[model samples]
Target: MEPVMPKDPEVHSAPAAVEMSEAAAANEEDPAHPETMAFCPTGWLPHGHRCFKLVSSDRWGSVEENCAALDGDLAGAETMDDYNDLHTLAQFFGHTYYWIGGFYFQGVWRWIDGSRFIYNNWHSQNSASSYPCIALRGAGGWVNTNCGYSYPAICVKRAC
Candidate 1:
């Protein structure tokens, strides 16, 4: 697949076209419902079971503290689709380190969340060997090491 790059950094993805017409009519009727927010699916952190976590908009603690401003330990990127959702949300926010599924255990690139990782790793890329957490770089369109790298990160919460 071709690289999916957004023209505008803070743009909300266009909801699927098939549902647009139906949604337009429904939108007029229920204006303030939770479903109405095009950008936020559930008004919950994940955004329609999509797994979106905001970092550092909270009081006390570091950016990790805000990791769960929307949810707690139960939060996680449930699938590749959900991780992709968080990735897009990171773009909208212009965040530095939107954490997703990647970790190094016994010298292997294992995904923390069991989703099939959807990223292209080049030879020069050195994340799994040196990073505790992974963050995607929009400019290079690659994931990189973030071990001990202090930056804002996104977290995920499971639906209860």
Candidate 2:
């Protein structure tokens, strides 16, 4: 399958074109409705059933904090489609270490949202470390890193 890339880095949406058109019109009518803002907010990118946003580099804690303030959490991908969407967004901005939701806590990898820790694309090296958080590596993989180090982040939440 061809990789999906956003024509504009500032926005993206799921492939449901007709539904999106209807939603857009409804959004015009009732801008405050949660349904209207469910898929993708004004500046966020949408894929499948979630919306994503890439924030500027900051310490891991701060990044996650910002996402929480916006009602999101650090991004996590359990499927290839999810990974592809996030990877494409990262490519658009040329970011290498965007913080994701996975973290090493209590001897296992877990998502910040408490979702089951399932798929992973860790780089083949010293990736299995005691670092508290994981960051997406350049291109399309992951690396363990210090949570205190400043790095960009990918925030994600359900699409309503």
Candidate 3:
């Protein structure tokens, strides 16, 4: 959806019209949460606040359907503590795989809330295969992994 801003012929015109979309609007967001705010390190749909990806090639599953499977979909996580809540959510609800707004794909790790990947809660000997991205091994909690891996990814968005 394109939001029309007030414009003038000289100072601003239709030519100056900016498309508030992913590529155009990207980098315009604040340097807060790195997860949802950052680029889709993994193939997922960015609903601005939430990033979502299909579990498999299953077209039967819609964004709402994926959201329905998650305990915290549109709620919007504010802090690491809030992300902690997703642990339980991903446990029982996820089927094949789900995306989370936490990764370090760009060398510098960050969360959807803009928090740096300072403290990782990865379980056991699991390590980050790729830089700047992480994933959850089903009910095994979170793991720092490469975004290149074939994992079902999810994103976080604000609740309207």
**Residue-wise C-alpha lDDT for candidate 2, range 1-160, written one tens digit per residue:** 3222212222222121122345442333244544434456655665556777777677788989989988889888787777777787678656556788888766678888776668878763243454667788657787666777667788988765
Top candidate, metric TM-score: 2
Least well predicted 10-residue stretch by lDDT in candidate 3: 7-16
Model 3: per-residue lDDT, tens digit, 107-134?
Answer: 5556655667565555532343323344
Any runs in candidate 3 off by more than 4 Å, and if so which? 1-80, 105-107, 112-114, 124-131
lDDT order of candidates, top first = 2, 1, 3
C-alpha lDDT score of every prediction, in listed order? 0.42, 0.66, 0.41
For each candidate, what TM-score against the reference? 0.50, 0.70, 0.41
Cα lDDT for residue 29, candidate 3: 39
Q: Comparing 2 and 3 by lDDT, which wins?
A: 2
* Model 2, runs deviating above 4 Å: 1-38, 125-129
Candidate 1 lDDT, 1-160, residue by residue in tens: 2222222223223221112234432322244665423332343332552334444322112444454344442123334554456556656656443444455567555555444445444213554544444555433233545455444445555443
Question: Whose lDDT is greatest here?
Answer: 2
**Candidate 2 structure lDDT:** 0.66
